[model samples]
Target: MNLKFLYFVIFMLCLGQNLRAQYVEKEEEEKITTLYPEAVFDSIQAKKALALGKGKITGVAFTKTAPLAPRIYADNMKIMLFPVTPYFEAWYKLRNSKENLRKRRYVYMSDAAFRYRLEAISNSVGKFTFPDMKPGKYFLTGNMSWSSTGSYNEHTGTSYGSYGTQADHYEKRYYTQNHEERLEKFVEVKTDGEIVEVKLK
Candidate 1:
């Protein structure tokens, strides 16, 4: 082949390769965009089921005094659902204290005491949801607290007889205050997939 013809063929081949690569990259990008839509759609359908009263609980948890407490949206604050039984109710009554039910640790107590639990974190607006729960009586609890600690040092100096001074001594004192609140209620779920509202006060 002549030099010009060979060069033209090589250029055409390079152009085809570039076009193929660009097409593949575009396909990959399109695929990524299309991915995960089904999951999102499924979640929307589940929420619709909740709206139709499909054994789901959804509501906002807030204090009665001020509905917009920062702790209401805190990540450590949680909404817990436990089956309502005599034993579970008694256990909740006994362990219900500021010290025991503070932040996320409130949900960490003896799980053996209850048959099972379903929990959800409060969103930025203090909204929580428990989807697809069984039809039965359930006990719900929500608690949150904020605490601050401070320390101070005290110095005491004494002078001995005639210009004699004793060494200086200091004592440190520390204090902490935990402001917390707890809300509890018993709810029943119907078999026909009913949405139940359990608001924490």
Candidate 2:
């Protein structure tokens, strides 16, 4: 083989490998993360919502992953109430979409933006409350998460007998899934003494 022709073939092969690697990396990134808008965390707005006032907020967090599956509760789970600032609002818009949320990556938030929020734990029935909340708009979030084993019966083959008699063979199979219910809601306190009722599911 001519030396120049052999060297040219090797260079083309290396270029092809580089392009393949870049394509794979881009695909993985698309599946893993998405760029989101940046917004400054507003301390004043968050502080107002965290203050004590006459307004009250109550809610329950529950989720039914499937029609046939059992309903799961956020029992003993920590819940948060945050002011609907620009940062959280952006996260909500992206997370609330079913197309974007289904078995996909979760939107990331700055630690500072996530900090300084009210928290409460849900009861056995997934009920929670935040008392003396300042009259303002806020976001209530929680997790109603659990996992369970699923199963199905599969037929391997049929066993034939004399006189047209036959028998069926079957086997049981099982699988497990993680049911992550990251729930959120928007609540507005209209009055100092008003009570806001909500279902966080």
Candidate 3:
């Protein structure tokens, strides 16, 4: 019976090795992002780290069409929080600042990459909270868009009469265009119980 038990133990060890090999192959086949070719997805690490600490993130999401435009609150808007892993670090570098982000508006990540994220919705006043977060660096993102319509007066040439030239005049011109505001920020939680407040505009 001792010899039989030894053979069973060896078979189980071989089976475990086979399972580990399959898992590694599966991870190798996963899709990757071209923005940061050196980045490898680490969903397990992100999730584990995200669940280890006790923290919270509170912020308000607001935006404007232009410098002189009115402040628009992101009412009932969605907010995404991602751990600053390698994949997200690459993404953040691509649009690190407002100027860089505005210039490269089409940069995107791979859809199939492993992503560990949390979500929340802003209230009517654009206030949102992500509680029970771990101590680490994170990325906060929100988007607001709408179409604005307005009218203005423009000076045109003199109107022509039936047989003679008429007087000069101004015409009312209407304009409408789509406007989008993207808010991206990085926040850190230093302790287990900390709150990071941000104005996510």
- Quantify all predictions' global Cα lDDT against the true fold: 0.62, 0.81, 0.78
* TM-score to native of every candidate shown: 0.45, 0.68, 0.65
- Model 3 lDDT tens row, 1-201: 699999999999999888777445334653433343346666677777578567889989988767998778888888988888777777666745575555554445555343567889999989999999878898888787657799998988778888896888889999998878788888999888998899899
The list of candidate 1 runs beyond 4 A from truth reads 1-53, 66-76, 92-111, 146-178
**Alpha carbon lDDT at 3, candidate 3:** 98
Note each model's CA RMSD in angstroms: 21.4, 8.2, 24.7
> lDDT, candidate 2, residue 9?
100
Instruction: Give per-residue CA lDDT, model 1, range 22-140, as digits (tens).
Output: 44433443211111111112333323322423578887776643555343343357877776555554555545545534532232234343335667888766788888776777777
Q: Residue 197: error of model 3 in Å?
A: 0.8
Best model number under TM-score: 2
Task: Give the best candidate by lDDT.
Answer: 2
The order by descending lDDT is: 2, 3, 1
* Clash pairs, model 1 backbone: 53-193, 53-194, 53-195, 54-193, 54-194, 55-193
In model 1, how large is the Cα lDDT of residue 79?
Answer: 79
Q: Worst ten-residue run, lDDT, model 3?
A: 29-38
